[model samples]
Target: METLANLESFIRSAEHGSFSEAARWLSLTPAAVSRNVAMLERNLGVRLFHRSTRKLTLTEAGESFRLAISDSLSGIQAAIAGIAGDGGEPAGVLKLSLAPTFGVAHILPLLPGFLERYPRIKPEWHFENRQVDLIAEGYDVAIGGGFDLSPTVVARTLAPAHVIAVASPGYMADKTPPREPADLQAFRGIVMRSLQSGRVRHWTMRDVTGREAPVRLQESFVVNDPSAMRGAALLGMGVAMLATADVLADLENGALVRLAPRWYSDAGAISMYFPSRTLLPAKTRAFIDWVVNAFEAEKLAERFAGSLDLRSSRSG
Candidate 1:
């Protein structure tokens, strides 16, 4: 029988396509991972990977072998973990991928409570701006908007991702506020260019009563990140369309003022994503529950509804 370490090393190396990356995830040296994979190939009498200077590519047999044993390996690991007392307490490195600004502003605050509850689960989080490959990158969970849900992954929405036009009070002081979404064309627009498409993004704003209008802002300034756009808007540069959850504090404190508040863009949902629920690790499950519960208790869903009046929503 092949050792579990050998199997794990081979599987991780295959998933990451680089021994160095596999080593980082597995807490082993690249040489160790390479040796383990070589040993596994020798034992099975088949070459699993095409070795090269840059990366590893799965051979035909290797792909077949991986598909055959991947699920089985997960089962075995879970079983071993159960026997080793992991089932009783969630203890492991819970790797997470989170959006930088929103993660810091909203999710980071909950870390203390989470750690207090599950002290044994050490968090290894990466703050990033892009949607991560949950399985390929080996993340336990990811929190953001607009993730492409694969067959192996599941998404639970935490709140609506509503985008609304905003501008600094100083910027708006010199101009008349737009009465409708289309009227925004007259103002200087601080807009975001799509990083994936390399084109300026446009929005169709919808009112509460279902009236939709195309909003065209004068792309006076362009950026690739939301945080930078928000900053520019705050500096009285121009109007920007930003998520309610991202600018909640700014809107609340009167640093930024909403424009055509009745009209907003539905960007999709801010969600928590993880691998399939089958054999889900205790730590991942625990963190998911904690965040969902907190969103409910705090009524963030209502607050994040861009079509609703923030002041009235809070007052009521």
Candidate 2:
């Protein structure tokens, strides 16, 4: 019989395509993971991976074995966890992937209360910009916008990711406010480049009446991150199009004001994602429930909406 440790090492190594990455995920040294995988291959009497200088690729036998045992491994772990007596309490590490800016500014605040309630659930959350393979990377949950909905995962919509133009109070002092999307071309625009495509994003602003107009502005500053663009706008360097959720505090405190209140870019839904499981772990279940409830309690959807006029006249 294959030891669970060896099986786990094999599974993680195959998924990550590298012993180092698998070691990181499993909290084991690379040499330890390699040793376990070697032992597994020895027991099975078949070579599991095609070893190369760069990355590990699963051999035919390895692929077949992985497919046969992946689901069973998950089942065994779940059974063991449930049978272990913390009195059904959610204990152990709960790994999560989160967006850097939004997650830090918003979701992080909820941790103190959550930890107070579920003291045994140790959160290991990574704040990043790129989409992660939740199962492969061993993340318990993810929070972000515009993630591809893979069949293995489930999503819960938290809020609408709506982008709106904003400018610092000082920057607007000498300039006439943009009444419509077209008028934005006259001002210095701080824009974001797409990290995935390596292209400058085009601004297509839509009003409340559903009229779409592309705004071409003189680029004064360009960045790849949303938080940086917001900072530039805050410094009175230029106007920027940013997610409403990101600029809510600035707009509320008069640090920044909306350019065209009715105009917004429909980015997508900000959602929380996790692997689909027949029985979710208590830690994961608790987080989902708490976050969903928190969003509702704070009226995040309404606040994140682009319908509010905090500055100049409405365009339409």
Q: lDDT for each of the candidates? A: 0.91, 0.88
lDDT of 2 by residue, 98-200 (tens): 8788888889999999999999999999988889998889998999987787899988899988888888988888778887889888989898889889888
For residue 119, model 1's alpha carbon misses the true position, in angstroms, by 1.3
In model 2, the clashing pairs are: none
Cα misplacement distance, residue 120 of candidate 1 (Å)? 1.2
Q: How displaced is residue 193 in candidate 1, in Å?
A: 1.2
Please, what are the lDDT tens digits per residue for candidate 1 over residues 124-231?
999999999999999999999899989999999999999998888888886888869988999999999998999999999999999999998999999999899999
- Candidate 1: regions farther than 4 A off: 1-84, 312-316
Which candidate has the highest lDDT of all? 1
Lowest lDDT sum, 10 consecutive residues, model 1, at: 307-316
